[model samples]
Target: GDDSFDEGSVSESESESEGGQAEEEKEEAEEALKEKEKPKEEEKEKPKDAAGLECKPRPLHKTCSLFMRNIAPNISRAEIISVSGDIGLRGRVGVNPRSFRFFRRGWVTFDRSVNIKEICWNLQNIRLRECELSPGVNRDLTRRVRNINGITQHKQIVRNDIKLAAKLIHTLDDRTQLWASEPGTPPVPTSLPSQNPILKNITDYLIEEVSAEEEELLGSSGGPPPEEPPKEGNPAEINVERDEKLIKVLDKLLLYLRIVHSLDYYNTCEYPNEDEMPNRCGIIHVRGPMPPNRISHGEVLEWQKTFEEKLTPLLSVRESLSEEEAQKMGRKDPEQEVEKFVTSNTQELGKDKWLCPLSGKKFKGPEFVRKHIFNKHAEKIEEVKKEVAFFNNFLTDAKRPALPEIKPAQPPGPAQILPPGLTPGLPYPHQTPQGLMPYGQPRPPILGYGAGAVRPAVPTGGPPYPHAPYGAGRGNYDAFRGQGGYPGKPRNRMVRGDPRAIVEYRDLDAPDDVDFF
Candidate 1:
């Protein structure tokens, strides 16, 4: 009975311990489940800020972003935002600090659906204060990025566009003023204004901003400002300004013609046979021969009167403008005017006959006048002597006789007798003999053998023998015989007269009556 009770108490204690361990494991599992659920709820609410406003996420893909490199270190996020707004960009901008101590780079991220390339193109080379921003996009979103400096390439294009706009604006203003001045003329078509909004904006900007600035500058100085002086080495600007002034002058002249003279203008026909017509400026275009139906004399006189009255004032204005420009360019208009007058007078003087300053006598030719001056006045005697000598030399050269063509003496005819010691079986040496060989010496064998003896091999042929006493290829015996004996002992021939006195009586004196001229 005692053993049984002990067993029951141990079993009850073991059951209580096992039950407590199970309860502890269940509580731990429940805690883990709650921890996982809390994170899920936080993710669901992550989009909202602390103030409950919705927050947009940044673009993480490269296709929606542009990489800007070589950004100036001093550039701030606000500047980027301003430039972006100027070009109509809607994006978030972020700058990345360079690895080393260098200029910072930046990235602009747009919505996924936006065309990144277009935005990049618009923002390319955008000026922000002193530094220009170089914007570019990588075709491959994940490719390595590099900076581009294309401002130099785009500068010319931008300048061209600005110049084109200026030209168009000038044209439009001129046309409008012309149409307004002439009530009979049709109004210019308005299609261009509506077709190009960009052009319209440019025109408006020029009229409002650029013209206002120009006028303000002009007003302050009673003329164009010193700061706006024509740039040196910039012919395009000078030409454009000159053209503008010319247009203004034309406009004034046209107004005067239309209002004061009641003259109408039209485009002249380009064909040669057509009657010439007045242009928009009321100037007639006459090409080739004048047609019969020309403007009346009275109308021309009236037009001339109007032109004089209107043109005088315009000319004065132009002169003043030119003087101002010349002053700014550090040039002297008085000197230029003097030079121009001198050149005109010189050209006119050159077209007429030359006159001697001393004698006041005119000559049709410059050479005659030069000669008269030198001969009569005795001026430039040395120069005149040189001129005379040059003429003499020219005449001498012109009259010089052609040189006589010399024909070589016909090579002496083939020898009648075979000269002693000449090679046998060969043509006579083509050289002429100085004289005949002595008689009674038979010709030698071809190979130096005795007469009627067997001949040896001929000498190895080379260049024909040099001209010897008896011509070429004649042996020593032939040369000796030609000289009438051994070498240096030539035979002398008799002459009919005394050889020493032959030239004594020859007369060399010139005749007294011979005149050189």
Candidate 2:
């Protein structure tokens, strides 16, 4: 009986534990179901408009930042900020130094609340002192220019030095001609005595020592010793002065080489590695080989050529990154690109047959198709490309706002000063009525002559013609009108019976008409 009781007790205890486990499992399932429904409940709770449209979070506004370029080097920060404020940009402005703390460019940063597009629109043609501010590019996207200030400064110095060296070297070449006029002939006579000791020494050193000591001489900055005292017009003193002048010429040559070396180094440091950072803001990469120490006029010419090639691109300012990328991708063939674009946007029915994508117009030839596209879709094509180029500049970022197009102001047409009671469609006051006469005027007999036909006028100072029953003389007409003859031309007195004459007088009294007698 004790064993049976114990077994029943154990079974009851196991059943109680199983019951607790089942309850816990049911609660866990319910919690999982609740968790699954949470998102659905949240979605249902979202507020809706009167029309039953779900409310979405508003898009965040972008902060406006503009890149200003071609800034004057000496322009102050306050001036830049003031310029920005003038353009309705209430924000922070700063200039980046392109040369020794002098700035050629800067940037403006504004809060998201400000409308950057409007400010940039007004920023056109903005000037800071003598420099016109160029349109800003993608400051965040483009690589920062390094050592440009030093590069530009040294470039200019090197240019001038090259010119001077070329001239001096040319003079040296011409001087070689003086060493001997013809083969085995006497040396050319100079200002100094032919047998002067100084001239002899100069000749020996220049002809004999130059080639052997060329490298050493090119590197050496050592010049002639100080001038001797009180030796005016002395041959020895004159020779010393000549020697110093020649040494000065060599010094210029040396100076040029040193600057070139410095400029070359600057060029290397100016831009990043092409493979590492391909986006160069469309700046052309130019790096000439290091020049020899004993450079001549020919090498100087080559250097000048390189300078010109580099300076032109720099002067034109940097191009967009899209253009540079296009060049890199071998998409620089403009004609091919144009053809590809045309092909994609248009439908080619056959060899010469084509249909316009825009207007659905058919063409018989490719030329005709091209013309039609140009006439119908030129502006659209340009706009699309411009937008694409703009977006392409932002390789890894959101597109920045663009400035509004500022169309040129059209000149006003010449104002029309129409008198009161006269409509624009009506004849002008000075114009004569053609092929018609006024009402209430009797018709005159035809003279059977052309427009120049002259009729017998009422005498100026005699009895009136019988044809005119009423007095129609010039004096009588003036007296009857109570005024003198009209201002310009003298009046032609006419017979009162003629309708042309009668109608002319009546028409003069018409409103909005000027009387020219």
lDDT of 1 by residue, 55-78 (tens): 555334433567777688788888
Query: Which parts of model 2 are misplaced by more than 4 Å?
Result: 1-206, 210-249, 252-345, 349-354, 358-368, 379-517
Model 2 shows how many backbone clashes?
Answer: 0
Scored by TM-score, the top model is 2
Query: Number of the top candidate by lDDT?
Result: 2
Candidate 2 residue 209 C-alpha distance from true site, Å: 3.4
TM-score per prediction, in order, is 0.17, 0.19
lDDT of candidates 1 onward, in order: 0.46, 0.49
TM-score of 1: 0.17
Cα RMSD of predicted structure 1:
42.4
